[model samples]
Target: MRKITHKKAAAVAMAAALSAALLAGCGSTAATTDSVAESTSTAASESTAAESTEETADESTADEAAAKNCADLIDAIYVQERTADTDARCEAAKAAWDALTDTQKEMVEGENADPEYFGRDTGDASKDDPRNEDEIGENELLVVSFGTSFNDSRVADIKGIEDALQAAYPDWSVRRAFTAQIIINHVQARDGEKIDNMQQALDRAVANGVKNLIVQPTHLMHGAEYDEMCEAVDEYKDKFESVSIAEPLLGEVGSDASVINADKEAVAAAITAEAVKTAGYDDAAAAAADGTAFVFMGHGTSHTAKVSYSQMQTTMQTLGYDNVFIGTVEGEPEDTACEAVIEKVKEAGYTKVVLRPLMVVAGDHANNDMAGSDDDSWLSQFKAAGCFDSVDTQIAGLGEIADIQQLYVDHTKAAMEALNG
Candidate 1:
């Protein structure tokens, strides 16, 4: 049913205006009988139009109320209302899901009808509120990421970064935002954890009268997401007295490879340590000596920035870490695909392999594409190659690493210093 919108309200007002004009016409004198008949006929037509419009307005009011009910039901999927209404909200959400058309369902891109929508209550609704408090200080630090919907990853990776920033800069209140709307929706519907987007986060900073603002992005590199985050900060540059943005986890990509080289070494150290421990080896050297190859799987894109993956591989090799291999899901650099990676490892005479995500969060790509039991998954294809004796995976994101967290803190410090400078 189509809801009565502002357009319908305008139509009702137009009908009322027409009725008043017809009344005034009846009061006017007609020069001829034909003129009088024509005026009378116009009055009848106007009266009919007014009555028809009133009937439509009445019907639309009911439809509008019904539409509101459906919208509320859809909202319940994401919102954690009062404690007492939880059960009723779940039931209403189901009913609303059933009543929605395909178009309405598309509007709800999250898990709206899931039992978990009302199942696991966090017990505090205020925690999920974007604008939890109206109180604001002069300085604000907004942390942004292309977030993960996985609850554990969200807490371990995203929250971990935010907590680090908050501790590092006690004067600046650290708020959170996610670039991925789908992840935001999924998290809200699945765990009732509401997060702000780029615009909303910026708007909140402005509304709170924050003068000095710093945007710290937790992205891995200066990829598409990072570029977009920079654009958003630039778009709202005038909203604050002074606004600055930090370099991503990895610093800028330039002709010189020092920054990315440093990042590659850091990641290599962090993940190699985890993979070694997971393999029951003493250390990275021990694992390397044992002929165990560590594969870092990144979520590659078709963007020109795909060279980052290739650059990582080069950095590793230049650092003399022959045991480390880098590959991507989309095979962006062409040679990083599962088949190509398997061939490389095989040619290198490595019989054991350990896989981990090169991404900030070990979410969907890490869980399914890399390690899942599906026949076409990386682990599966590697196993099918009949070369390696053992294959393992580490399900931790880069954000979970302490050294990586400190790296982000260092970047935040630089950005803040630049702002102060």
Candidate 2:
């Protein structure tokens, strides 16, 4: 009985020990599983945070790329040459600009592209017509110019001529063309206005099936631009039944400096009269008597037609207007240079000088070169010379004058007569 009792006790002890071991193992297994689960959860959270950070970085990079693309596009279209892709590039530039956010637009920059390129108020473009419309009748009068980007000047000067032509030739359709592709591109990009280049304008005329075409150039003289315009018109002459290009504002550029024509005299007389009146003088003689001299600044050209400036000076001399002077920005004739003109004015003993642009439109050359505050500008140079008591500038072009417009009208009439003859 004692042996059996001891055996039962030992068996009981073994069973209890086994049960405790099993319970301890289960507790350790549960703790390990919980630790693994916690580690996995922490790793998942880290992965999610890393993904978000990468996404944010990618978004930032994309925005920067978009802004850069917009800037580059603007730079691409701000060019002088028009290609098959020019229109498309211009549209792309506008689109890219539109796509940029406000912050991105503020960051935009390029060689010729800036925030104000399309943002600046250059007057209401709608006030002026592009004259690029089609569906023309038989007779088409195409008025061509070197062109200006200034909206107000364009309307007052170039459009003034166009309107006059339209009114004068009510039987014909008047169109417009610019010789400077740069100006055309600028107007297009900045103001959403498209002025046709010479080639485009001629092609447009041919496409319109116009039988009679008269090209009236608003150029100041027969210079390089005039030559190029003639070349362009020559190509399309066969397309029209009759094609005639009228003389420019200065008429035919004579062979030499001594060759003065009626056109030069008219221009000299008209401009001087206008300047004298604007300066509160009764006439050129009165202005001269008052110790004041008028200096007319022209865009001196390298072409042989540059003699026209010299001829104008001669015409002024012939008119006995000793106080009136002629100068050129390019200093082509050497005598008409700003320095030379200043010496002439100083030697002539003029106390006051009034500067005016002799060019057709009071555009860049008139505003900046003739009258700008820059040191190299004519106004600044005249002031710096200390030769005059007071220097004043008239920011007016020849095209603004009624007499000048009449001269164009007369030239056009002559061309039209010749075309019919």
Candidate 3:
């Protein structure tokens, strides 16, 4: 009986020891599994933070690139549209500018290569000029001319006429157009001055939705340049509600001497007044009496309108100014050639001569052809003739005169009346 009881007690002790061991092993396994899960959670959080930072950096870089592109496009369009190649650049710049969103467009500042830049008179125009206004008028006055590349002359001569017209017609917006592409290119290339050609000016007017347009030519006569302006006006006539053209500075010459007589007389008198002032004479008669022969130089052409030069000579004679002689560079009217003029001045027994340009602008013909230093020029040829004791030159254009400007203004009024009639 004692041996069996001891055996039972030993079995019970072994079972209790086994239960304690199993519980301890389960606790250690649970702690290890919890530590592994915590470590994995921490690693996943760190990877997510790193990716977020990289995404923010990429967005910032993209914004900077967009800003740079907008600036580059603005500069490219600001380049002068004179040459054919540069015009292509302008077109491309325009395309790129158009592609940008409103947010990107707002990024562009100074230099004004924006949508508002078009048809906005941003330069220094006169205060009285209607073009200085922000709101453009329905009626537009386009002043067309064979443009000069000279910056100062272009402003003083061409802009002068436009300003006058703007002042006269306060309701109209005065714009500029150059018929000569070569001059436009020359000015832009030489001086970096940008001017609108015939097509560009017309395009701007059309874009602005101009209703009434009147083209007043600054040309001296109805020559080839005038004819070309007329053709351009005819092409775009239907674009406007009403379009009319004004006569040139010298008015019309349709077989009526009276119509152009006033211009010739005014030019002759104005030039004589200026000449006498330069010669230190009291008046035109005084200059003629002092044996100072005034030779007015003109830009003669092969156009049928060349007869205007002959008519001017006849008008000068009718005004009883025999000392004043008219000559041309291209030798139009045959009698107005430099050589013929020289002989005529000698025959009139003039000892001294005054040379001046008869054109509206004292440009290439006046500066280089008439008064240049080259041996082939008119000044050199006149000096070579050995006809006068001394020859003096006057560098001034007809457009500089106040009366000439008024004449253009009058012609514009007449054209408006004619269009209304």
Candidate 4:
């Protein structure tokens, strides 16, 4: 059925009124000439008013159609892979968005586009580098990450790692790539900052005639993202003479809960120490003695490597971080859920809780899922559990810590050494 929009309804009403006036005029045979003239004048005035109303409605309908078209354009480009038409599509979407009036822009909506699609103020995007420039030498260090749309976190965490790698390996050209193309499209659409995806970054290196390529992923574990990064590098391995991929922040995923490695131990110590110092405590034991527990939230997964989260918990326990706990947003292992962690903290008789993200960048999970005021967020869940005297949050990512950055540097160094060897 054809939907009758408001403008269509108004047009239909105007046409019906015109038909009625014509019928009344044709049936008025008893009226005098003077009365006929007066009636004709009144009819002419009504017709003019109807035409004016129709024009306004038509304009409004056109504006709405334009805004919807722009939204659809944005939705089309919000994809994981960049195609041959991606550049043209991006240009078209930006043009349409710019042409919209302030009011029309607000009306824009799509599967992934909204007013916040281009209007949200994350931070000054200019402060951070996209690092997509060309004219690179043979050796290229491609830093890959899951990526974040939060501008400040991107600068402080992701860019922080890239800068450190550039300084450590002055001979290699450091470039950036984000695994999430949705974030890539978002940053481009919102801030005009064009970040390369894995394919683009790799292709860039191949095109620039880079002989050696090193991929350093800022991921915390050998989970889905890390596996995907490895697959991407395999596709481009033949392009470079020597291609090496570094270990993720957490080195390896052990078979079961009983396995823990040096990488996990370092992360456990570093994050706990940072959290303790930030919370104004001397150490984890001191915090525990004071009836405070620190919970680290990770982005859980359904993959078999979800054991990494469990191993992290075990490593904390083995390190004697009795006050530290591990939790996941997805609750993959059933024991790492927010509710489960709360129960553990309560059982341990800790009346105070501090929550922080174990992820590289304190992006959406850290800002919204971990510390947001929503009822389902970790912060709200802990407070509503009524098991703590206070529930505080530390809105910092692991990448911001000097020790965490050094871990990536160390991993990159290992990869470089292996490539040389």
Candidate 5:
């Protein structure tokens, strides 16, 4: 079939599967499994098409269903809702979501649009005082987000983080800024969200009579985006006279331990608590017993901080999840990382496998690359190798992480401080 356009690629990949399977017979499922194998959030457009999000009313449980190899081993990742009584469906769903890659979550979050993403409106956000003549006050926070095309989800994911921060520091006034221009226009056109530009957000902060400009980015890591944000902060450095950028959610300076700890805690408290349990399962033991290997797809970066993925994997293993492994789309644990995992499962005599993404959204990669039924996907290759029996998956994403979300809150809190200081 002819290649799809950039805009439609992500939305239609899986939908194309029917056609792909019909024309190619799912052979090896190889041609472009890599096509869907996007491992980074920024590159999600290159990830899988819309993921398969479903809920099978007939399946007894994900475990039972997968035990029966209830699926074809071609493509990867399908976030579906199942009514089966498998341990704790809620927990399972939570685990499924936590397992998404950063890229997956971003693609999903991208669904949010202008005013649709956020609640606040820009009734009159124009900067009457075009110049910054007034003294920048303290007790101010600056929320920096990658910005989204989908207003509603963007409000929840990024702005929600800001709101959390605002709540934490009730004394400080929070001003929002969109690092993306398209998103700003979108807000103005749709929801009347009044953020004009970095200048406007700053003017609003000054108008609020705040000084401290605590800048926090809702980015997954420290890379070009983070760097640009830093630069942006510097550009406005003299204006505030007091500014500091907070650590990114998944950055080198960010507390990986805290992030992962939040992950474990979120899983323990989620609806699927029964399956994963408060006392997480023994990774090596589970791997040995089930003859199953677990692979996590992370939203990795190409920056020097990319090593964080390896560190995260090490941290998970340190948590005694010997069978639990982490890989990224942009950095370490490249595609071949799965080869080692496949080897381990083979050595354990397990013919089947379970693959999940460790992300905030069940977007492109999570659905098509990691779990689609196409031949070239991770699921396809594992099945082809003959050691993978079944792959059970979900798409709950990481939006549920209280601490991760709190990270955003913290940034805003700090930003508020910068504004008011």
Candidate 6:
């Protein structure tokens, strides 16, 4: 969880050293000033104020330096053993891993139980190996996801989920499938990589002699995209001597109350805890206090966006955050739902609240819509309702957060276990 690279660590060290120097210089000046001013005027009060400011500044500087140390993965290689051509990257990645501690290395090379599968124990080049095809057994697992659009971001979200599933089922040969039509199309169009369709990805595995295919979607919930994936998978279910496509993320069986609670807690903590720490909301204890409200803005879809937003609303209530509310730029559980929140704040008399995004990335909605304070934005409307003098906003998206993605990983593990059973 705590990730750092050499370069990042060095940068942080340099920053901390600089901050230390500044603080020491300030300390020297204060010593001189305090000694001189003790008999002149209100030296104790000035000294107290300086000490508090210094403490606050030290904490802020530490946080900023730590944030800077989160390592840019642009230089790191992922997707090892993907195919024959992938060997160079694979080797580089292995070397990179060899240099890291066990924990740091796990971030690169997966921590899967290393359950030997039927496939060849090969590196990135094995995709082209005929012998590699001979290596796979019939009982194999394939994990599908939206395949992150951000090249670097993909390493954790999709790949991390795949690794966890592999660790859970040590015997199953696990693979990855991305349902991100737009993203895959872009990758294929801009880059010359031969991206596979759902059927094509399946066929590739089948051609490699993979049997007992277990296709599991890593989506957040069931919707059109999930249904479409099932359609693609069913067309080839008969191709395998034995095949069963597992449920999508939050599949029907996963909707139980306990599971839902775990998911909601993970989601809420994933999105908000970092925010509360990152923004120093500790001083705003009153905001998290009872009767205090928080508005979450979800990206509304023309078709099935309501499903995610509505479920998210229920999840918030289940978390015991009664003042929590969800609204979208489109669809029912409409903006009027936000209006109702304003009415509540007006009546029950809460003066301040926080706004956050309920989508993957803050990209456009969080910036231009929810917190923009534009007449059309939700915060602007809340302001008009006289709910509070100020409304703070967090641009963090649930998908961008690693812990939230683990929830998807958790779903994948459950579904794979079911298929294994």
lDDT score of model 2?
Answer: 0.86
lDDT digits (tens) for residues 241-359 of candidate 5: 57778767644534443344442433323312222332244434654465555666666665665655555655555555555556554435353265655675577566545566565
CA lDDT of each candidate? 0.74, 0.86, 0.72, 0.89, 0.50, 0.54
Q: Which stretches of candidate 6 lie over 4 Å from their true place?
A: 1-140, 152-156, 167-174, 190-195, 244-286, 290-293, 301-308, 335-353, 360-388, 399-406
Candidate 6 scores a C-alpha RMSD against the true structure in Å of 19.1
Writing each residue's lDDT as its tens digit, candidate 3 over 1-421 gives 5434444544454455454445556567666456545544554455455556666776666655664565565555544345557655545555555566665555545453444322223233322121323247688888887876444556666777787888999988888777776565544433345567788888788888888988999998889989988987899988999988998876666563333467667767776777678779897678788898889999888887888888788777887778888899999878889999999999999988889888877776788799889997778888998878888898777776777788889889988998788
**How close is every model to the real structure, measured as TM-score?**
0.71, 0.80, 0.68, 0.84, 0.51, 0.53
lDDT for position 252 in model 2? 82
lDDT of 4 by residue, 1-421 (tens): 1223544555565566555555676455554444545655665566566667767887799888988999999899889888888777888888998899998988998888787777767778899999999999999999999999899999999999999999999999999999998888878877788999998898899899999999999998888889999998999888889989999998989899999999999999999999999999999989988998999999999999899999999999999998999999999889999888999999989999999998999888999899998999999999999768999999888998989999999999999998988
Clashing pairs in 4: none
* 1-421: candidate 2 lDDT, tens digit per residue: 5445544554565455455555555468776556555555555565556566667877788877887888788888777688999878877887787877887777778787776656555567788999989998889999999998778888888898888889888998999999888678768866789999988988888888899999999998999999999998998888889999999998988988888999999999999999999999999988988899999999998899999999999999999999999999999889999999999999999999999999888887898899998999999999999878999999977877888888888899999999999
Rank order by TM-score, top first? 4, 2, 1, 3, 6, 5
Query: What's the lDDT for residue 290 in model 1?
Result: 89
Cα lDDT of model 1 by residue, 69-107, tens digit: 655665654542234554455466556655655444434
Which number leads on TM-score?
4
lDDT of 2 at 341: 96
Clashes found in each candidate (C-alpha, N, C closer than 3 A): 0, 0, 0, 0, 81, 10
Tell me which of candidates 4 and 6 scores higher on TM-score: 4
For model 2, what is the alpha-carbon lDDT of residue 246? 97
Best by lDDT: 4
By lDDT: ranked, best first: 4, 2, 1, 3, 6, 5
* Candidate with better lDDT, 1 vs 2: 2
lDDT of 5: 0.50
